[model samples]
Target chain A: MKEETIINFTHHQTAHCENGVVSNLMKHNGFSVSEPMVFGIGSGLLFCYIPFLKVNHAPVITYRAMPGHIFKKFAKRTGIKMKREKFSNPKEAQSKLDENLERNNPVGLQVGVYNLLYFPDEYRFHFNAHNMVVYGKQDGRYLISDPVMEEVTSLSEKELEKVRFAKGAFAPKGHMYYPISFPEKLELEKAIVSGIKDTCKTMLAPIPIVGVKGIKTIANLIRKWPKKKGIKTANHYLGQVVRMQEEIGTGGGGFRYIYAAFLQESGKLIGNEKLIELAKEMTEIGDLWRDFAVEASRIYKNRSRNDAGQSENYNQVANQLDHIADLEKVFFKKLKKAI
Target chain B: MKKEEVPQDKSNLESANFRELCYAIDENGEYTTANSTGWEPKTVALNNAIDEINDRIEDAKKRVLEGKTSPIEYHMELHKMDVGILASYVGLWQWRVKRHFKPSVFKKLKMNTLQKYAEVFEISVDELKTIK
Candidate 1:
């Protein structure tokens, strides 16, 4: 007679969602892995500015690895047994999740950001790849451990289903996963080397819309905002960038700081002083990202009353992004050789 | 974000019973910690998005009251989705969704289509048929 049950899931708040969800799930499953360590070993550091991919009429610029990649890579690196499932039928998915929870297992879920009632109305959007965990159900509520929030929250079963099957880019499709077990030995050094190499490769990729090239492309487009797009249009675009970098649950610096934290932990674990140095540089670069957001925000402070937007202001912010791109190029190359 | 820079006046943050925790570079330039109070810019970013959503809702509600559209359109607006997004969830094409916006077509929508939208919105088919 399997029925409703609540797992004693201890929630530890962290910088990013996927990293936090997987980290907390690991902890509940008897593995001791820090959020940053999970982030690092999974090769979560990345910069892709795919301009053609539009969300809300702006280019998709991201500062981390693609969704679900970190968890997949982390499980593989640590030799942990993990199970993931997606359902064509929401009812089946909910039943499977209920069965898992009935056994006291906490399940990680990917959901859209727009419909979670606990989310600040201002922060809700059509973003479809946010991650959280469901530990149990009681009465008519699903207990959720969303890492970005300060505390655990509850969602109605119906509300949970709506978000689970939310449509758009990177749709969750009722996706859920749980860790089964882990090997005694972890391949830390091997994972570190591969992570550094992949990050460098993405930065040096030849395509103009990815890696460092993509940053350059975005910089050029941003610089032309005032002249080509006009003040009102420029304000809208700049606000969009700020929203992507600062708001979209990045926690900070478009998630560069989290990757930087990962680098720090990996450095100490592997005793690579050079990695420590690279981590410091990454932190500095992360500051530059914050600076870019601040300056861009200054350019269009009040969208309704903004009258001072200039080509120079747009160009100046563009130069800073280009500068950041160049700095990342240097950091990634050094990271590639630091190992 | 710095401790001094946290915004304490965002009403929605408290209303939703949600608080944002951020990773900020400390004095030693390390990113190993987190701050859950609030950041000014992050709060502002959210405030902007909420404003956008509310604006859409207001526009959508106006459209529906005038009989230019149906409750499906208003619900989608409240959810901050376009026809493309709503279509994908309902497994319908964008044109069908566009047609669904019209009251005449929406009234004749099959039970299956109505059920799909009801599931998407977390509302009943009866409620979905009438805009509040």
Candidate 2:
């Protein structure tokens, strides 16, 4: 006999998946942490261009930190005790998940995006780092709260198992996590300060492949791509950049808007006027990134518009990125001072 | 973007009955969340990616029909997998997977070998042996 259980879990849609799951789970555990706060405290924003790591036959250009990093960092900074487990055997994984549900425990699960049947058709791809919460089991189906979705959904036992053990890069391996305990009081002000400091240091890091320097490196490549790799491959690479920035549940502008919102809330909470001022500046920067995406997409979509015009468009977008990089360099320096 | 300026452009996602959340500055000059049907630039990029995948699948189907490559290649493309990913799923080396792409090599694959691939693709052994 199957024991049916459903824990009362609320679903709140957010701009990104991991942050959404983290925020929602915290709420269920009686801590009302907003999505942007979770993102900010976790220091989730980042820019890295790894040339050797190929995803979909193009170089990996990531706009944020790696999968699971946000939740891990958020828990650590807030002094939340979380229990995480991974299983090598599917049967064991299934039984463990069932046991948790029987005890009315809601758990966050790392899964592959490809096999998630509820995803929109266009968003279904072989990406392996998606996260969701499983709060209940009823009639042999698992109730799911995918942070990217507008409402809660469900999946059959076989379907959930497939994604949990999905193959390829960053495979889930049946990974599940949930909060076991929390500090009597969260040190929000200190966490926010440290988070801001860490982010500032990362963005200003002295490295070619990460932070502000990485943004410049991509801008340089955008200018060279048309001539170096020919129009077709160059356009494909440009599409990859846009997809990473806009798609993948980023809430747009590669999380700049979310970070700005975080700063605004943090400023109000900690009574820091400087952070409020910088939040406005960050919003403008996010707008600049959206503008860059527009121009980049135009170039890729209209490659046959004209050769001279195409190269000119590429340069224009590259210039836009360079300008954003410069702005970010200044912004992070200011943010570091403000905090 | 301003809350009012948050784009609600008609996009492919609209047909999917989903709205993505966006953070923007509202009328009060405060940050707030809004639901976006889609943005044009993102839609174009997303469509381009989907088109590319569809094109690859079509090309793979043509090759399989001509017996130029094995059914494995077509099925892999259909599943949005490349050599590296497919190899990982099947617990085989990438080079080995590539070698099996030849029609001749695929024809003589052992039952267990074929079973491994069938399980990965979620198809039957006989189904894996032929092009759809």
Candidate 3:
């Protein structure tokens, strides 16, 4: 029998997977980083509507930056060195993971969500951008630290490999990453400012398919979906939007709440009252998002609704989204000036 | 959203035995993390998506029973994958994947091709050959 190896890794449940994994890894490395800090410093927020791309038969709407972007940016801004490796061969990937465990290193991995047996059944889908950490190997089962989960779990060798190499859009392809080096002291203030600036620029970008413009574009689509796609398809599209906003792990309200928390934390740290005030405004915007979701879901829930009723509900939801877009536009502009 | 206002609506997450962590402002006007049982709107959207997938699975099963398509279609839906995604996993072209949907074409497929599909679904070649 092979010897067992387990690193002393602390599991911290977090709102989103990527940020949680990054923060947990930092804690393991003797750096106490909060999830919001990781999210903010990594500039993890975004709103992109990719009408050309399809996921689960609906146009893709993402609430966060692309997978691995957070860790990549966090490492770059803080002068931390990260080692990311992808393997074409499953055998080599498993061996490399085992090697890391033997060396007492907990490795972060990007895996598909569908085959995560430990995940809640309702949450398992064909999403391929989920992140987790493997901290040890014991009796042919790997110890998993999925930050979104409440507790640590274990997966057998086959189960682990299947998700590690799960195939599809944004397929993990046996991707593994971990921090290799850290500076003697991280420049937190500089990193925070840079991250905030990057987010402000992205959120205020002039592109129609992204940023604040993207939110309005979605609002426009929501208004037309009922007439153009019929009630069945339109409701499905609306449900898709809500799922992307809330179900796919945004800490509720499509990451707005998370960003507000980030601003609040950074405001206290940087001694900026303006940012603290703006965080309250952001929270209100988040409440508006939740209201939009609730209103949209009402349309899809009442399947036997008359055409007139359905269209009115759609209009209301679309109006709510437009309001959110406007609020976010003004909020980002104010945040930009505050920073 | 305020800390006390965080929704614990007792949705699908209750069955999953977990609560989602959410960010909220406390009474003191400070940011805090709170655990939510679930939210109603999220639960509705999640159930809708799952129901849609189940509906597709049922349709695929009907086609398989009528012998209008191969077991591959049923298994594909059961595994929560589309033809394009399944094609990528099996290293087959999209046209070939659609062609294999026909019972006759799937029957003529060789062991190697069958092995590829079976590997993807994590089932044996024999299991891939027949509907359960």
Model no. 2, DockQ: 0.74
Order of quality (DockQ):
2, 3, 1
lDDT of 2 by residue, A118-156 (tens): 887778788888999999998899999999889899999
- Docking class of predicted structure 3: medium
Error of 3 at A172 (Å): 1.3
Candidate ordering by TM-score (highest first): 2, 3, 1
Model 3 chain B poorest ten-residue lDDT run: B10-19
Better of 1 and 3 by lDDT: 3
lDDT tens readout by residue for model 3, B4-86:
99898968777768888999988898889899898888788778888888888899989998999999999999888898889
User: Against the unseen true structure, what C-alpha lDDT does each candidate score?
Assistant: 0.79, 0.89, 0.89
Candidate 3 lDDT: 0.89
- Candidate 3 wrong stretches, greater than 4 Å: A304-306
Output the number of the TM-score-best candidate: 2
Q: Give lDDT tens digits, candidate 1, residues A1-339.
A: 144578999999876799999899988877778887888777777777765576664456777889989888888877888988999899999999898888888999999998887776666778888999999888778889998877888998789998998888889999999888777766677876776676678778889877888889889999877778777667767777777776635767887777777787788888988888877787778778888887877766655444444777888999999999898887887888888
Higher TM-score: candidate 2 or 3?
2
Candidate 2 lDDT (Cα, whole model)? 0.89
Give me the displacement of residue B5 in model 1, in angstroms. Answer: 7.2
Question: What would the per-residue lDDT of candidate 3 be over residues A1-339, giving only the tens digit for each residue?
Answer: 247998999999999999999999999999988998899999999999987787777778988888889889999999999998999999999999999998899999999988888777877788889999999988889999989888899999899899989887888989999999999987788899999999999989999988899999998998898888888878888988998898746998999999999998889999999988998998998889888888888899864355787988888898888888898899899998998
| DockQ for all models | 0.47, 0.74, 0.74
Deviation in Å, model 2, residue B119 alpha carbon: 2.1
